[model samples]
Target chain A: MKKNEVPQDKSNLESVNFKELCYAVDENGEYTTAHSTGWDPKTIALNKAIEEIHERTENAKQRVLNNTTSPIEYYMELHKMDLPILSSYVGFWKWRVKRHFKPKVFNKLPQKTLQKYADVFDISIDKLKNIADGN
Target chain B: MEIKFTHHQSAHCENGVVSNLMKHNGFNISEPMVFGIGSGLLFCYIPFLKVNHAPAITYRSMPGSIFKRFAKRVGIKIKHEKFSNPKDAKVRLDQNLANNNPVGLQVGVYNLEYFPDEYRFHFNAHNLIVYGKENNTYLISDPVMESVTSLSEKQLEKVRFAKGAFAPKGHIYYPTNFPKELNIESAIIKGIKQTCRDMLAPVPIVGVKGIRMVAKLIRKWPKKKGTKVANHYLGQIVRMQEEIGTGGGGFRYIFAAFLQESSKILKNPKLAELSTEMTQIGDLWRDFALDLSRIYKNRSAKEDAYNNVAIQLETIADKEEVFFKALKKAI
Candidate 1:
């Protein structure tokens, strides 16, 4: 891309008002660095990925509200983590983590187990046990 | 105490850190030169490996490999350490700072407060320099940022010990020795040859073949995975290519810059011509990304949008195959 041709489209980066450094060919055909606010294609792709995460988080929240799953599932989705990643952070086996997704199993969990989940999510134990409305 | 570090923003994080650190050590290495000497360019698509719930596609070498390769090839002695606990990591970092040593650190981007929200993710391969610490804040020289920034002690600790795939584990590295003068000519030649080998590797999941494999998967995704999932997959490809500190166009432009610089250093005019060709290929990659985005946005006017983007990728693969072959012959 030419130096002057670098995309400067407004994007989600506008929230932080940051410009990304990019490389382009100057008038002399020499490579140089240019700052890009964003490009349309990248912006769209990022928005789509973020949207997917939000959709999954919302789905998990609904399941928790219906008592189909536990608050662990909701918090995991809220933090953009899948089961394997959550298990690794919480130092639990994959199957054990999956078991905790059940409200019945999660409710019977000890304070230590709840504390591990709370620590990973960087939230309080009381908050981990209860789901806040409109979070 | 500050180590008098000067930050020069670059197109990629690892290259930026290496280049900036080299300059601080009294060597003037450009970012592209650092990237090129490190043989940082590659294309790989791992179907079994998942990142962000999508198949992993990497446009560069593994996280710390660039600096490792670059240092070895350029005859620089370096030291690297990874701590299991943050307490030890903090003590070591403080010791380095007290001695006026600026060290590069591998950290996760998720909790980096200076990063924009849109760019924050669980990626743990981001590199930066910790030049000094004042009270509770660590001075940072993140190469992707326009200016130097700072992170609180707790925030820095959180990112350094971030848990997930490719966890940073409080990693720290710095160059300890350098030759009287760099062998730029041989280093550039070696870098070029390795890149050629990587691009032309025979493995189906690597190099030029890897690019082709992704093209094949793109054709099947819409029919097999449903539109929503396929669109998400396509978005993942573009994000990996353009969004993640690639210097735009999947590090192709940086490689092109490297080639251009090498042409002047090695006195090989053939490399200059190839540099232009590589830039055109980078443009092709950008076009492919734009077309893929159009399909996911439901704005593609073409009847067979998936097939069209797949064809675009195939064309890119074909050009890259021919380009690498010639590049190998040029040196």
Candidate 2:
């Protein structure tokens, strides 16, 4: 790729940070180098990913407040996991997981089950339970 | 203790680490050269595996394979270890630094505090070099960064022991020996042949054919799944292409640069011509990404947008099939 060759009509160099070295080619057809003017298109794409994850987290938080789902759902979404993954991690069947998505079912879950989930998420059981309260 | 090491950032981490390691041993090699010599280019779309709830779509080989294969081809002996205890790992790392050896560390990106908040993710295969340690901080030379940085000992411990898919498990690697001379000709030829074999592998969800498989799956997505799911899938593909490194062309541009350098090293004009073709193909990928982005940003996008993307992907697969076939014989 032509280093520092910004694609047209995509971005401006206004906020660009030209500190990172990027690989370019010299007139000799050999590998040369140039600093990145950080407004590269890849930065835009990365920002989009961050936005998507943020939105998912926010939506999960809203779901917990409405009591439509339990804190387990919120934690799973925060950890970027689906029901299947969470089920396998906790060694519970998918149906058990679906049941656990309810506030009542989750509140009554065994300490062992909560500990398994907390371990998988690398968080304490208290933090896992109080996730909806922004703990 | 600190080792005298120079850092140069690159588009991808593995190739950059390998290139720096080569330079540390007094062999000046570009990241693209290391990438090509390792036969790093690949495509895979495994629906059974999910990354962030979308099917896993990888642009290159498994993590660390590129460096492993490159080191083997260059006849370099490298010491790699994984520790059960972080304390022991820290001791070993400090010992290596005291011996004037820089260590490559595999750590998760999620907990690397130096990274911009927007750029940090749960990726576990991120590679960085630790060259020195102060009272509480360790000097880090992450390939994707603008310059060298530092991390606290506590912060380093968290990332090193990060738990997730492809956990690092306190893994560290450093070169122990280097060949006196390299047979560039044989290495280039072997690299090219291996890349060709990998691209043409018979697996339905791997290699160039894998691109086609994803295209087919995408075409059916809007109908088989709902528009919301299909659009999310489109966003995921673009994410794999542009966000997770190799700069915006899904590694096609980097590989094209590699082919260009290889042509000069091997004195083959055909390879140079093929390198130009590869650049055009890379541009095609960029165009497809641009189109996909429009679909992702527009929730009310027409139903045909998914089909349009599928068509673009199949065209890419067709071009790549011919490109690799020619590459197989170009050597």
Candidate 3:
């Protein structure tokens, strides 16, 4: 029940984290590589939730970037934001995107080290590739 | 394990109105220096059946517990069983040294394959401290025979109880003394400290030049153009606290490991040290997380499991029992 609702379902029940966003958008396990029943549920949910909320979260970011005065306006401009924070208020997605989504700038380093950080934060390798390719 | 110093000062800073109010008083006094140790700790490691009782921290004389008060702070009504204050509540609180109450307790039953007969040993208690005048003293419910010892049998007699079953449970002592376990715990601390240090790294670059370097890549959004910076800052701090909290748990794990290491290790060493640190760090982190979690979790919604500090700590002990069963396999 975020102020700015987006979408909600078992598909989006993951924590609103970077990896969660990437997973939700995953039409299939094309990017997941292999099965991992051994991972912590929170970590797993975070990865999938992030994937689901990716587009809506980005859209919401764009809206907020444009303008934000009232709560309604704030919701309209953002993708996810539970206006009045609630525990059971699960809808559209909890407006926890900003908490998990942040801009990262890494130095030119070996691919292994960079990938480790991504794994720690559960950021998608493909997204890192996109960022690297952009440069 | 090693913990990051972070300026060697953990005293909370209160500015603006809080600072102004302090000026009204004569001498400068620091508020309770709150610290977040870590979560998923094993305060009471029992290998048999146990009970997870919710630890309740209140004014003792006050109605309900801190959980209820926190609910009140957030403007929510919790239908608690209203009870009249106990006449001994004040007397007990006065005699006791700590200002807090039990958060909760845990109960669990374990099946031992070694013992064909499943002897059920249920633990029904919680750790608490009586308030101290200066920094405060720690209150440990039980002292393991083979880990560490802070209080000599003589010192145990000197301690007094104010509110709960601490006196009835027993004195604090360590039963483990193996140097290997201590060294290992210390190494783990070092590892944790290193991880925290690496995480604290500021922006890879600084200054306008660094900004330009970053901008050359991903387009930078104007600061606060879309979101409130305060929220993000708080979130980052929360995560940082979580990382360092491992140190808090490492402190206890070292103790558990020591216990596993030997009966000889626990004899004369200062077990009270471990108990004190665990109680101190546990109280600080558990206290805050309980409040914050309530807001983050239940909110104005239905009550959740272990939502308050007392209940949460109780759950920790229960989880520890889980660890104990799993850890037995290690032995």
Candidate 4:
């Protein structure tokens, strides 16, 4: 936390707007003012968060391809949601959400249910069902 | 219509918004000053109020309260509204922008496009400014961003109505009147005393004592929930400290900086000494975060790691207790 303290180099610090405190001395040397300097450690923390999201998304993606999970599983992971969170978002019971992870049940989900999931994930029903190639 | 507003990035959103809005209206104020005057600093670890499936661990007061308090203390009148209808909300916002009036809004972070992909979360207390609109996009001055940006009306609506946990509910605010001068001296003392009261409040789950409560829980987490669950919970604490709406070190550094500014304004050397003490507390908080990150990086952290983190938390709580008590008596 010095005005010029450098953050330890971390791979995830790329493209981060880490906020930090910076002090500026006045011309009279009577006082120093503190201002935000935007430092590296902030980015490192954010990067760690993003890495967690991507790691979960990747694992969920693998499950979908292996036919062990449904596309809802992939979308949930992609959006960094846990089962309880996704359930709350879609207003579904957690048990039902766990059931929706099965391809058989997920494929039979009502259009309205699909829409709810789509809205929560900020995607369209088609994309939610398809688990978009780009995702 | 365009409002000529200057945006300065700051460590926390609400403080930045207050600072920018005040400056836009001809008042030169810093974020820390706004924060301190508003009595925005507080610590609470509520176990029942879940955010993202973890207990609510907040580093500041609830959203919108700070601005309201700061405005009142400085003798400024402000207008605030929360629309139940998204359509009506958008119309009202557009009307304000068309009048060349800059407005402050609370929106969820998950859908803010300018946010880094990894940083997106369901936090609903993020503050930003909307100064104008062009075509389908609304010009934005999110204090956390390096430069002003724009968001599509569609995108804006989505985030405005973001549903889960601490929903924004289409809240918007703007200053209706401004005072020419402020009682800086009185405000500073009031800020100091209020901060002390909050930190030393008798509530077992809040203030300095709350920090200790969380420390105790941290020590127990591993024993009750196994290592993986405990590590994830610890990571959540670090996230709240370093990443979430909190400024660095859970607002410790920002509050410390506020004290430093208060010292100069009030010409009190004792407050300056206390400011340095607060900075040391911020350092301790940062060290705690570093330790948490190291545990996350190395999943095989032993029981000693959790105990060490708990001890750090206890030490921070103890220091803050003393600091706030002294701050209360100093003013």
Candidate 5:
């Protein structure tokens, strides 16, 4: 990519006060560093991934609302985490985490286990126990 | 107490951190030169390892390998430590800062408050430096950022001990000694040779072969996994290549820049010529990424979008195979 041709498409990065630094060839064909506000292709790809995360979060929220799944599922998606990742953070086995996704299994859990999940999600025990309306 | 440090932004985090740290210690090493000597360029597609719900695709070497390799080649004695507990990590970092030393740290990107929301993921290989602490905030020199920033003690600790894959458990490193002068010519040759060997490795999951493997998988994904999963996987490829701090074109441009700098230092005009060719190849990778985004975004008019992109990747792989061969012969 040439220095002049570096993409400056405004992106989500602009909201966070960051600009990506790209290496581009200058007019003399020498490599130089250039700051890009964003590139369209990258933005599109990133947005798609984020969209998927949001969709999952929404679906999980619905499941929790119906009492089919626990709030653990909803909060996991809200934090952009999957079962394996959430398991690692909470120091729980994969099977145990999968079990916790069930409303019955999660409700019977003790304070210590709930505390672990609460800490990993950075939420209070009450918040983990109760999903606020419209959230 | 804070050590006086100057920040220089680079295209990649590890290169920038190493370059900036070297400068702080009175050694002026450019980021490209550091990257070259460290042999940071690589391509690996780990099918068994899932990151972000897609197969892990890495465009560079494992995290911290660049600094480790660079320090060894250039006769720098570095001290590396990892803490099982955050308290010990905090103590050691404070000790380094108290002694007027700026230490490099391996941190996760997810909890880094200064990072853009779009870029914040579960990636744990990001590097930065802590020069000093004031009150409760630590002065940070994240080389990817335009200017230096600060992170609170709590925020810093959270990222330092970030869990999951490639988790950096409070890792801290700094150079303890440096040679009177660097062996630039010898180091450049070693770096180039190692990079060539890596790119041409016989392994199916690494180097040029790995790129080909990804291409093959792309061709099968749509039919085997359905369009939704296929597009998600494709988006993962694009994100790995273009979204991360790859300096554009998945570190191809950076490698090319390294070659251009090496050409002058090694007095080999052939390297300069190859550098231009590499740039063209980098452009091709960029094109590949663009086409991929189009397909995932449902904007592609091409009938066989997945197949077209797969072909494009194969073309890139073929070019890279030839390019690495020539790069090896050039030195």
Candidate 6:
């Protein structure tokens, strides 16, 4: 032990109550070095944390990578997954447009165009709307 | 729809239990969370599909469930290894020994394929029991189960199974406790504690900024609820003191820690500057611990706080007991 390193007694070690320590964090990161036990909880906690980090770094690499996903990463991963999007005339129209394909001027005259598209896929109007407008 | 960050709040239900948390979420948690040791569920190894958070709700188990699940554990692919690793090896060995000896369930299931007439398996689940082609032959049958003496198919048939056998063949039956589902409800409870604590854990510098957050909570809290709410909120705050294990042992811990640290500060003339902030923080926590202790003392008076807790715990324990008893009797 260093000259400045005060040897820990039972009181100092006991004072660092786990409940208060937990609450000190809960009630706004309020903490004190002293507890009944005279143990430095922050140091103890920090050391424990560092130990756990090292343990995880050594032991659970795959799990860490899997759990390390952020919201953006989650979205990106979801996008990468082969999401099934129904394809049809109207769907084709939207997909084509969304893909930056120029909409043909005479894409389809009104009459049975929408109905014909729905007929081809055997879907309802709502599903067609969902497919077409990205609902 | 995108699972927004806000929805995370709703993800846990009114009671704070989660019916199901994307399975991945389930994997993130350990079993200690839903552990109602006495009366929660019969089979410990029966993989929970919908761990309900509510105390009222029980495992959707009917009769005969224990036999099926226990049998699965007793089946095949049972591998035994001598204890070697330092971490979980002792615990595993102890559990195994207890299970193999008696009173502990250590078997697992293996290749339980469904056929028209008979089920096929490659190995016995329990190595403790020998499979000599007769009743005693229980060495191994399935990959999931291991370490067993007696507690066989014959025993299972004799034991009491739940009347509800509409469940899958692999479904566990229990005569004792119906499990409380630990889904959104538990997540909410845990989240409330963890998130609330996490929010509280920013260095609350004793001056203006620290005061501001407390004031903000006061104002925002009022806007959300009236005096009743305030009282309840205060009660919650008080409850948290206990939840975080504050009043019981926290004060002693803090005092001792501070005493040690403070002594070092006194001794270290050179590093004396380093002790100032640490000392201040330590002092505040000491004070807080005292305040929380006072609250706990008061709260206990209002009701038989521990009695209530014990009562609540008993219900859970009873179910577990019944389930295990029924399971033992059945197997």
Interface RMSD to the true structure, each candidate: 1.0, 4.4, 21.1, 4.1, 1.1, 20.8
| Runs of candidate 3 exceeding 4 Å displacement | A1-56, A60-135, B1-267, B295-331
Instruction: Evaluate all candidate structures by whole-model CA lDDT and list the values in order.
Output: 0.91, 0.79, 0.24, 0.79, 0.90, 0.25
Best by lDDT: 1
The weakest ten consecutive residues by lDDT in model 3 chain B span B30-39
Candidate order by TM-score, decreasing, is 1, 5, 2, 4, 3, 6
* DockQ values, each candidate: 0.76, 0.31, 0.01, 0.27, 0.80, 0.03
Candidates sorted on lDDT, descending: 1, 5, 2, 4, 6, 3
Ranking by DockQ: 5, 1, 2, 4, 6, 3
Put down candidate 1 lDDT per residue, B238-266, tens digits, no spaces.
Answer: 99999847988999999999999999998
Give each model a TM-score: 0.98, 0.88, 0.21, 0.88, 0.98, 0.20
Name the lDDT value of residue B279 in candidate 6. Answer: 35
Off by over 4 Å in 1: B299-303
Provide the lDDT at B124 for model 1: 86
How do the residues A1-135 of candidate 1 rate in per-residue lDDT, one tens digit apiece? 999999999998778777889888999999998999999988898888888899999999899989999999999888878877788889999999999999999999999999999999988988888887446
Docking quality tier of model 4: acceptable
Q: Write the per-residue lDDT of candidate 3 for residues A11-126, one digit (tens) a residue.
A: 22122210111011023211111111111222222333233345544554454444322112222222222322211111213343232222232223347644543442235555
What are the per-residue Cα lDDT tens digits for candidate 6 across B1-331?
Answer: 1111111111001101111121212222211121111111211112121111101111212222222322222221113232223234334423433433211122211222111111111111211111222233222221112121233343332111111112111221111222234243323233223212322334442212232333344344344654333323333332222222121121222222222332342353322232232233334433433342332333233323323333433343343233223322321
TM-score of 2: 0.88
> Model 3 lDDT vs. the true structure?
0.24
Taking chain A of model 4 alone, its TM-score versus the true chain A equals 0.70
Question: Which consecutive 10 residues in model 2 chain A have the weakest lDDT in total?
Answer: A9-18
Weakest lDDT window of 10 consecutive positions for candidate 3 chain A: A16-25
TM-score of chain B of each: 0.98, 0.98, 0.19, 0.97, 0.98, 0.23
Lowest-lDDT window of 10 residues in candidate 1 chain B?
B295-304
- What tier of docking accuracy does candidate 5 attain? medium
Q: Give stretches of model 6 more than 4 Å off.
A: A1-135, B1-214, B242-244, B247-331
